[model samples]
Target: MIGYWIIFSATTGNEFSYLTKHFLFNFNNVEDIFYRNYGKRAFIMMKIYSFLLTLPLALLACIPVRAGVYEPDKLRVYLKMDKRVLYSDEDVVLQICIKNVSEKKNFFDVFDSIKNKPGEYTTFQPLVYDYSGREAEITVPYKLEKRDIKELIRDLERRMVELAPGEVFIHSINLKHIYKLDLNTRYRVKSLFYPTIGEDIVITSDNELSFKIIAEKRYNKPSEREAVQRNISPSEVILLTLRAEKDKNWDNYLKYIDVEKFINAYPEYTQKYLRANFEEKNQIEKDFIKYLTRDRDDYLLHYKIMEEEIENSKRIAYVNVIEDRYGSRWNYRYRCRYMLEQYKDMWLIVDEVATVMQGAKR
Candidate 1:
């Protein structure tokens, strides 16, 4: 009689050890039976024994093998908005909450320190879909081209913060200040939070947040007159233009500016160049406005209209803008001179130039 043996390694913690088993059977009478039946019965018995011996091993192969115990996910994310419906001009405050659901402390970049260089940090990239299933355009506050890559990397490296187990971190962002949403439209905003820059672990909310923007109440009702008219001065035009620029209303900005006169004054500036430059300037205006509106200890002291001169249809205004940013870390001021011309009872800005009175830290 011949014996069969089987060996397999059982997986243990970072090590492998083998276990062997043997099966023994007796066929001492098999020689006499083979001579009686011409070995036919012996061949059938051998095949049956071989199959019976290997059946258990074949069934064991189908069992799942586990090298380690299962662990729960480490992070959980949540997205919240103050109001589901709001006016188009109103700001939508988005709150992002990240909670560490694991037992051990986790290290992650909170993304609070890299506002000017958003590309360097993992962010809650948002996707907004309109009612028609079309994606809307969302503009970020800071652009990659505005910051140096090395500086951004340094900021990110130094900004890594720690979150304890079961602790939550919350961050709020103003959607109106950063993005342009359309009026009278419903949008679905979905966001995914990436805790680390180089890792693949991303946490997202179970469901998306929905919001609607309706037209302003004032604009909903019809008026008796064709249009409401208000008489604005040359100085008022400059202020209104600045306000429009701060609001990121590019169309309203061009409304107050005489593009034809601006182009004629600066022949080197083609229409395309003028439009592009206006958009760039609008972006700068958004940044400065954000700084002014920030919830910080610093404050804007005051701004003064230095001088205003009107000659025939042409007018020039000089203004001084100052702010006490971060308690004298740098003197923030701008000396701006605006040129305007009277057009159809409205003062239209023709051109302007500004010089930084004081430069900040590089």
Candidate 2:
């Protein structure tokens, strides 16, 4: 048994020694093989992982962004007239004011200045006062930006200096400018070729002008008024003549001379017709003469003396030809308000009130 044990122990020891030597001998080669083939695989894997991690960043760098252009808004202009009714050839004063609300550049020019041509609108420019007169030549270049405002004022005195005699100047404005913009490349869509934008700087501009010109004095002559001789109605003449004859001694022969007195009292009342020799025999002439002769004296003194004699002379009731006594026809004097308009030939009562004198100049 002891011999068998010793032999087994020796065999086990030799097997152990052989396994340890073989492991030590192949260790270097195994390491070399791992580093050559597997190392390359690991390096390749690392490169793929790095690429995956950076892929999103690379895509973000190439992505497009939107761009835009901006501009300011424009303002508008308005005008008004104080009066509209004007007499022909009358000199009128016009007030002009200009305003702007915007961020942009604009220019203006006026007519009448030597530099300005005919049919051109006027602008506010610097003027110089010299020995000769006030001269406007230097122009002001105006620059504005967003929410900016500009104002200009003018009076008729300056306007008259520039205005030509008998030449009518039509005032107006012009908006010929626009805002420019450069779009960002983000909107560089294939459909569009250029990166530009355009917008109106003036939201509201001068669309129309409110203006008027009038003459200082009326061009019409006073002689243009329709004129005629006053004539008493036949009924009135008859009543007045009869009253005169009744008050005095009624005599058939006295009637003839009384008619001359009646005519003298109310001078030239339809004298043309009375003097005219009409071929037709008419009762109107006889009746007219008789009517005048009857009240010749009293009719003549009615306004001059009779009205003065009557205490608290009753208001003489009057009825116009139109027969509308209730209609207003009088007005307050020196307190008349007026509107501007081309005066018509027809006469207009100052105000449609109810008490005043009806008078005519021509």
Candidate 3:
């Protein structure tokens, strides 16, 4: 009782005023009010009551702040999944973000900067389930043939990085390529991740990663998207490019054409791009897409890849294209000589020389 009086008297000066100002109610002077309302005994008791009310905040302030904190709300793992409606024509990309929201640095070896899915090279292990929580079917048989994890670790040792506080390392997985998803059914995907990949450190994904594959495109006819593939033949690349444009599937249409390469092929655009700033360069790429799609009259009607020639440095595709537009009363066909080069896993149209086919039909 004597100890309580000492604590209550000592706290009633500044701390009592703070607590009352922020938490309860503000007064000119709490000690004067309490003393005036009652004698010293009642005054002491009321001060003790106020002190008890603010005890938790006082105790929390006494706890020392520490570095390397790994709270769920602080440290995070989550998917940056995107779809303009999956199964439409876009890749089912599950971009994983491993972030360090601490005061100190964090290191993770779970994956390289890029990956198709979690595996020996990719490291994290994933579980995919259907809408009913049943294990999803691996529609396309996945061949997990690769070197051991030890070898991958040895090879990637030099390239690993430490994520500084407030930094995130991201990598993506194409779920559609990994699991066979039924149209309109939701799918849940999660991964077992060890930041160190072998031993102890843990970072958990706080969000439930889920998405659905909806067949928004008409199912009665064949989808050209099926032909939109990685590592496609040069002829297929040319064929899909024209077809994607005709169907107005912007993602696949631009997929086969490397916009940077296509835009820079023209000397004027190339010089302008080199002199332009970052924001302007992005505008130039958008201009390329706009130039292709802005006029419906320029849309391709029918295109046949006539020939594909392969040389040591580059590949060339000759396409005979039929052009028609409601805007044009009568227009003929075209012959486009497309120049392509190997870009990552597939071919992209880098350049094209088109000449109107004078004798061809409208």
Positional deviation of 134 in candidate 2, in angstroms? 38
Ranked by lDDT, top first: 3, 1, 2
Q: Candidate 1, residues 228-298: lDDT per residue as tens digits?
A: 66678676776666665555566676778765555544444444445666677566445434543455553
lDDT of each: 0.59, 0.30, 0.64
The estimated TM-scores of all candidates read 0.37, 0.16, 0.36
Identify the superior model by lDDT, candidate 1 or candidate 2: 1
lDDT of 2: 0.30
In candidate 3, which residue pairs get closer than 3 Å at backbone N, Cα or C atoms, i.e. clash? Answer: none
TM-score of 3: 0.36
Which ranking of candidates, highest TM-score first? Answer: 1, 3, 2
- Tens-digit lDDT track for model 3 on 179-270? 66677777787765566555544555666677787766565575588667545778888778878777888788888887877886667678
lDDT, candidate 2, 224-300, per-residue tens: 34454344332233344335544554453233233322332333444544665654214434554566446432122
Question: On a 0 to 100 scale, what is the lDDT of residue 108 in model 2?
Answer: 27
